[model samples]
Target: MHKRGQSFLGEVRDQIRSKEAKDFVSAELNHHLKAAKNKWIEKGMDETEAEEKAVVQMGSPITLGQKLNKLHRPKVDWLTVMLLVTTLGLGFLPILFMDADYYLQYNMDASSFSVQKVVFSLLGAVLAFCVMLVNYRRLESFGWLFYSIGVLILVLLQNSFDMINGVSILVIGPFTINSLSVMPFFLLAWASFFNHKKLKLWHLSLLFVCSFWLFVNTVNLPAIYIYTFMVFGLFLCSRFSRKIKWMITGGIMGSLLLLGFIVWPSLEMYQLVRLLAFVNPEQYAEGEGYMMLLLQDHISKAGWFGNALNSGTIPNVHTDFVFVGFTYYFGWLAACALFIVLALFIVRIIMIARNIHEPFGKLLLNGAVALYTVQLVSNVGMTFGLVPITTISLPFISYGLIPIVLNAFIVGVVLSVYRRKDLTSMRTFQPQQ
Candidate 1:
């Protein structure tokens, strides 16, 4: 080739070598060649001659060495997965082996109390695992739609009058759906996840008002409070400390004002009893304080080793006061171990949230952590008389199917965050494992 032709080949080769050169080559190459080729054609070179001219004009293919570089992929944290699965197994197996009859005397044969509850709990985990395999970012666009559907289902369930043995499956089914409770969690989290929660005051105001509306309509303070804490946590994660302070002040004042004016319950009845019982156990002792008395007395009998499963005189040891079972049958060390696992669960969620660079994935993980922490603190606190009982459970430790299933699904969302890649930002990453 001529010296100029050699220079042309070198330029083409160098452009192909550097991947970054792709944009420059893509934009300019065809135009540069077509013009050069037309000139050759107009001068009476044939089509094949013009094509040769165009190829030579762009430079030679031999110099394209950059194509040898391979694209990089993100690293997976398999250790995290292994540790999580092991913990879940430990947490779940106790409930499976303990036997349902050990839980409640009255409803021992009921479907809610039957062995099938375990299936629902595991199913929730299964569903969550499948969902985690989906890329999480893709949900932002459809968040509102998913949220609305969750709300609509509760609304429809509320209108039912049918009952099994006087217990309505609609309002408090084998599950519970206080429109006021679950919907706020679904919607507020969705709203907060998008846009780094760049919500205007009106947007926040709207969520509160909608929550209050649903609360009054349904009368579910425990669920509403759970929802409130979750939303507030999401907002805190999204905003600055100063804004959080202002929001909290406004929220407290607004909550008290609403409590005063509305006929709605502020301290949900069960929680109110736990509060009053803790304060004046004598005045409320016979009627409302009975369970607390039983729980405290049973825990007193528990020593270093603790009595065996059926040895304790505790009633309802498997359900509401299960932590007492941990303390009583398994001893204080087991109770301490319960908290340790709970701590591990929350810390794992925080680590996942911190590692994620994207806003939505972080919010998803934050929501899961906040939700679990709220329930964990209240349930165990009430058991020990530190906080009022609000009918909350110990997350995965509690065997309630409906709520546990929902929590399991949330875990799947956390798994989605870990599966994402660095070079390719997929919307949701669903992992098979």
Candidate 2:
């Protein structure tokens, strides 16, 4: 009966709630039923009998629909959710105690900055979730737009803005946005789409030139290094040839060395002193190396449990040197726990990146993971005098608005990739008969 064919598809549609699942099942069933009907027709059956036979041979529509529904369901990554909760719990705990009136001994002023920090943190969290809901493929269309905006910001900051203590901050009315923190996100997004059939020299040159100008203008060495590493990771993960990979690697290395050469001479005496202090902190303990010396002193005093937040008089202890202050306050065991959680998060991201189905998504995630890894190492290393203090914020634990929001957005994009790891896409469509 012709009605049998209609009944079969309708039964499948009734079993599956999502249109995507229903369409997919209907297409597969139609394809199979057409073949079965042809087989029956060639075997001497009439069209109506053939249609009825095809419906029977295609198996139970309810069972097939149930299986397809299970396959197409959106999967939530519970592990990532739990890890993020642990990270946020540990990260916000310090600010809670530091800013609370009951804990302040010297009548600390309760400024609006603290309230804004919490507000931005919540906003960042919401932004990340919103980004996850968006289709990542759609973001590819805006790659150049994002890149141009970043480059434009750097250009404006270099030429039009007045310098604040020798560093440029883009001031828009009431808010001063840090160009260093924002530029890398755009650059990394640009890098994600660089994979091509043939690796063009001009494309590579464009990337180098933009990165070079950003580095020259901002003079934020740590951010530049992270951005550079991200570019490297992006290229390495791309589908380029081995020769091209080597060439890109060499070009990046050469460019970094040349940039350092050009930027080094322009550095102030104190900046040069800070670079030297990384080699030997004690030799310059009273001068530019004082931060490193003080950081070491604070870390040394913090036993396994910490000095209960009695971090010595290190300037900007709550910002640049917060990790040391944290270890000194919470103890080394808590620091180790923090380290374990961070390590697991990075590892989880890497695992997800590797498993991602799309090349662009994979490359994008590689850049993000590389940026986070570099920032983590740089910040933690600075806390113990292992690396030069470059004023880089610790990824999730830092006390800053831009870093928190940007990091949340990055994590959200990664989660978007993870959530849709199985299906390359889902599109609304009508089922064909």
Query: By TM-score, who's the top model here?
Result: 2
What lDDT score is found at residue 363 in candidate 2? 71
CA error at residue 402 for candidate 2, angstroms = 0.7
lDDT of 1: 0.60
Q: Please, what are the lDDT tens digits per residue for candidate 2 over residues 118-197?
A: 67667777877887776676577677677777777777767544554466667779666656656445644555457444
> Least accurate stretch of 10 residues (summed lDDT) in model 1?
65-74
Clashes within 3 Å, all models in order: 18, 4
Output the TM-score of candidate 1.
0.70
TM-score of each: 0.70, 0.81
State which candidate has the highest lDDT: 2
**Cα lDDT for residue 76, model 1?**
45
lDDT of 1 by residue, 1-433 (tens): 3344345445554545333333334334445555666778899997667767666544435433242112212234564455445544545544533554554555465455445655755676577667666666667777656656655654564455344422113544355543423532474345443344466656765856664555444444566677777776776665446776687769878988987667346668876676678876667768777767777787788776666655555555555667777777777887787688767778878877777767777777787787778877887887777776555666666665655665666666667667663323322322111
